[model samples]
Target: MDKLQYDNLYKFLVSLGIVLIVLPVAALVFLFNMEPILISQADYDLLSDFSLQMIATRNKLTSYFISIFPWVAGILTCIGIVVLLIGIFKWVGLQKNLDKKLDAEAAIQTLNLLKMSSAEVAAKIEEEVKETVSIEAPTPPVSSAVNDHSSAMNKYIEIEDLCFNYFTKRYANKYSFERNIRMGKYCYDFIGVSKLNNIDLIVEIKYLKIAAGNSRMIYDVFERVYNSGVNYETIAHRNFKCVVVIVTPKEELPRLENIVETYCKAHRENASRIEIKCMAEESL
Candidate 1:
């Protein structure tokens, strides 16, 4: 049966049982203590029996009950007590089961809420990624007088955004990411913290100029990211990891792998903690 119905039924039964027990006990008490109020001794005697012998026998029987009133009360009271205990046991069992069912239902609701929140976050991140990708460079370059690296910085900034969002999809609701993280001397492109998984992600980005075929770019990019990761790792506790994303032309993929392999050979132990992601320039 439904828990509420079960509870109401047990409560009603307990209350009814109490009333039944109380009324009988009250009637017995009044019959003994307030006998005059119920029916006076003079009236009882005047209501004549058929014979004097019969009247004396009835009086003897009545006196016997009066003498054993305590024993009679004790026996009836024990029966009432047993009924009360049975009702109490039934209520307790019903309530305990109800509590467990309620707890289970609450847990299910919490899990569903987490799933909904994860879906919303995933949706928002996807929408922002599309917007970032669709944004084309301005016609005029904003101004001709800007710093030499200013254009370079502007060009690769969306690439940075793309990389951050890429991992955000993989991590989903498990981690929360922040961009332009400035802590401990150097500014990091992104930092993702996941308390649930006990993990921290340090993301660094390098947009390679594959058009110039700068083979030295591989060495420079790896060195820079490795240094930053080492510095971050100094203060980082356990479960610290790094991802270095390189945006390059499709032609330079082999060169990128060679550089990473060389680095890994020299530092095999730390290699497991670091990961690399290479992307084609056109894709971004």
Candidate 2:
């Protein structure tokens, strides 16, 4: 039977046992009080010596009850005690089983809560990065190209190599160039992971005079780097850093730095997670 049924049955048995034990004692008391004398005092004078001592001191009704009721009382008391012990033992076992079940359920719930917290942390980081890029650094249009396509491509490659070498030296064995970091529907450039502090790194090299819209490319690079870093952090539970190296002439470095400084000032909280550097083309 179920726990409830067993509990109810045990309670009833306990009550019945108590009644059985008590009823016989009460009946014996009543019988002794009502039937006090077993024989008449006048009859004692005529009786022989052996016959005078044959009868009980109490009444015959009490004597008859004493002969049969002692066995009945003993049997009832034994049954009552056994039933009470069984009920108590079973109830305690059921209670312990219930406690273990509750503990298991609570453990499962705690694990689910931790999973949800992990997802929220990832989502919050992604949202903050998106906001910083979209508001502080708006995408620019494809203006007239300042340099021819062939020369610009060669210059871009040289600068990218220089930046790679710089980071390789700085981060030692932890640096990677053109590593596949998957963002939404795209893979980004130069993703590195630092084991020392659990830092996710994204390095981008920007050459402004390219035939393509260099200003527009800057926003795209920023967004992709941040998203990729956030994705990595979510999975690995690491800190993320985005580094953008602008490759322009020495004369133009001041203007680009001013632009990056303006962006940083606009979004100070998000800016702390990013680094923007102006590198001269001559250095490449």
Candidate 3:
């Protein structure tokens, strides 16, 4: 039965037991008092001995009741124990149901992840953009290519040899790679002291074209890196550094440096904290 129905049934049983136990005591009391009124005067003399013996017998019965009172208490205690065991069993069943629900949710998430395609992922990205636009916080704009490059760079930064040398030179024992770590989600780009010490870093290289849009893209890259560092600082309590390196054609180095300086200042970060290095055209 349901919990409420079972509770009501138990309550009815308890009430019935109380009534049954009290009725006999009340009857015995009444019977003892009625003997005096019911007995005749002529029979009183001869019946005196019998009445005395009857009274003694009643006393013995009362003694028996007193002795059995503990048994009634024991029965009630047993009922309480049974109720508690039933409640525990129900709780265990409920927990099992909850576990099944969680397992189903996990399975659904895995299936959704497997079914996701590039187009669908892009649509999800656009939806995320719209949602961010609706929020009060400033939304950082990132291009699909930049996003992909950033993600890849983050993966490269977690390389054992790279992360070890990167953090050991600065903070020494302050950071340990013994523990598993991740990028963006756990740590930011590989440039902030907080993130580098606490988590691994990502180094991204953006190849720029000689166009106005490319110049703007370069500026955005710097912004993305700075934002990543800011994000790490805001979330991570440990000390680390994430470095962003930009590789451009030899001719574009001067302009890139200027843009990097401007972007760093705009983001309220230091230029020295980031490495804007130029590499050979083929090297990039």
Candidate 4:
């Protein structure tokens, strides 16, 4: 497991070993010296009789134990040392892996930030030029078919109230009253659209009762979008796309799957143009 757990286990084993070795040897020493606190009157009488009977014996019970004590102590000490070494080794290995992961994540984040900043700068320059130079610029015509399609897509608004409700309920006890409050809704789904030279996208939140089925549909949508010549980077930067996310009880998966599948197929063309994904309740 973790370094803390390993270190704690090692410490516990070392403590146990010390107690086992020291307590037994200390007891033997007290018994040999006939320490009053070490033995009761009954025990002393029994030992006296045993000593008399064993007068011809070359070894005493305490003496035998004392001779073996060093070996026992040495074995326990070695075991404790080995356990500690193993814990240290595991801790070092985990730390190295964690560091590598963190460094890679940091590099990725920096690259993404730079890309976004560059796009923003380009957009700003385009806006400035349009405002400064307007010499009878040809009026851009809007297509009626495109307008109708955009309106139809906009009509299918995804409700995100359920997701907000789930999170608020999930974290109620952990947050304060004010902190626990949720605004209108939390959205995490996006809709995709394709134009001649540019793509339009809309982001909305939708709730799905069947999370696994929804996840599969999301994968299908991503595949369709990718195949439709839409790159992930364009989708990420486009503002016309909307995400539809749905939240429902996890147990409703079986009943909700059919309904979700039906909806996905009915809007297959529109859905194909978009990418979808699910975040589990636990993740939220």
Candidate 5:
């Protein structure tokens, strides 16, 4: 059931239980504590045989009912208490599950919004660059590889800027850009701490322009991410993890996935602590 339905059901069960117990509990308390009044010997002797016989029959029936009343009340009270407890525990568990689900949904929504914002920023930058190039005189043609490399480098810088902006806003006081932490021989692009969750984050941003045959960029960055993750774990001696965000064209995702799978397979232990996410350049 949905949370609201479950909530209503919980309230119903609690109300029903309380209703069930009220009368039985009151009866038990009053009936069990009550004393039977006895007639005096003189009054008993004055009774006719016929009257006495009728009185004896009536008393026998009353005694039998009185003996059974307390047991009935006790059983009903127990059942009511059990139902009440069940309703309470069910309500508690339902609330906990809803909280977790809400948290997960919120996290996903935030990531999606970040992606959309980054995409808009990248598009604006590309438009400005195109306009500037159109105004300038035609320059000499550079080699395909060099031109590709330069374009890829510029894209990486843009991605880095977007990520930096995102982390500053997201992590606020805990995030740093190009933090100089001596993790062996390498330094990561960003570092942050989650004080609430007790986790340290190492973030790496890369733009793999492999769709135009610049595959080496992804491999080199992946290796660096792996090495940094290992070193951070070794030196920091605490809860630490690595996040690698790669921006590439959608056409190259299969090849990227294969490379990532192979690399992670070879370094299984560290791979568990390293999270690699690929974003389509078109989607920013």
Candidate 6:
């Protein structure tokens, strides 16, 4: 275990041992040394010997109970404290594990972007515009290109890395991220994680353009992707965001954006945390 965890365990065990050892001994001491005030003060007033003996017995019984009750209460308090600590420890451990699904953190993303410059950003914007005027309608990915999209995948990953790093700058240490992960039936291209809380982001990238005629498919894809993001949030009791990316000709961005915005408006409730980014390959 890490130092933080080891310290917590050590403190809990020591507290438990102290309670177990000290309480009983303290209770016994109180019982043995307890003085019966009223009974002792009136001992001489009792005329019947049997009455005096009964009073003495009652005083001793009362003393024992007085000593034992507080000790029982103390023991209960200690037990309760231990139980609460266990629950809290378990909760922290669970939070730590929640982000384990993602191997990288926002700080790492930021470090990778340290060498990037303003010129690069300007150049990328220009590239996106040029790419838009160059390519025609959404054509099918060549069977060869479709065979292994790893190069395109790397391009999207690079863009996502930059986006996440810039997005989570202030809370860099409190977030984690991953790429090309399978949530369920679908594989999300990127995922952002929250370390301090249960909020995460899911991202999917498309290297081709969306057709206007594919509204049903688009809507269903959004629903499935949104649900996939929610699945992780539900399991970890965190909030989630769903993002869709399109790497198409720059001219086609407006059309794809409209389709996504329409779907977002239709599913406003679940789509509140949903986002779509339509860009050209050169932009990355």
Best of the two (3, 5) by TM-score: 5
Please say which candidate is ahead in lDDT: 2 or 5. 5
For model 2, residues 1-284, the per-residue Cα lDDT tens digits are 12223246656555666666677777777766774334567777777876745554334645677798889888977887787677667657656656655543443343233332334434433443343334433453335232333344455556666777777777765533333234444343465555333455766656654212244445566666677667655644556688877767777777667766766787686667778777777876
Model 2 / residue 180 / CA error / Å = 5.0
Candidate lDDT values, in order: 0.60, 0.58, 0.47, 0.42, 0.62, 0.58
- Which has the higher lDDT value, candidate number 4 or candidate number 5? 5
Candidate 3, backbone clash total: 16
- In candidate 6, position 243 carries an lDDT of 76
Give the lDDT of residue 27 in candidate 1: 60
Candidate RMSDs in Å, in order, are: 14.0, 18.9, 16.6, 15.6, 10.8, 12.0
Put down candidate 4 lDDT per residue, 14-130, tens digits, no spaces.
455445445555665775687323556787677766674664253465567678877876776676566556655665666666665554444334334433233443443343233
For model 2, how big is the CA root-mean-square deviation?
Answer: 18.9
Candidate whose lDDT is highest: 5
Looking at model 2, residue 236 earns an lDDT score of: 44
Report lDDT (Cα) of residue 21, candidate 2.
67
lDDT per residue (tens digit) for residues 96-121 in model 1: 86765554444334323333233443
Q: What would the TM-scores of all predictions be? A: 0.43, 0.42, 0.29, 0.27, 0.44, 0.42
Q: Please report the TM-score between candidate 6 and the true structure.
A: 0.42
lDDT of 3 by residue, 100-219 (tens): 555444433432333444454344334433332333123445555467445433433333234345445755433222212233443222232221223334344343423223445555
Error of 4 at 39 (Å): 42
Per model, state how many residue pairs clash: 0, 0, 16, 23, 0, 2
Model 2: residues with Cα > 4 Å off, grouped in runs: 1-147, 173-184, 210-220, 235-237
Ranking the candidates on lDDT from highest down gives: 5, 1, 6, 2, 3, 4
Looking at model 5, report the run of 10 residues with the lowest lDDT sum: 131-140
Range of the 10 consecutive residues with the lowest summed lDDT in candidate 4: 175-184
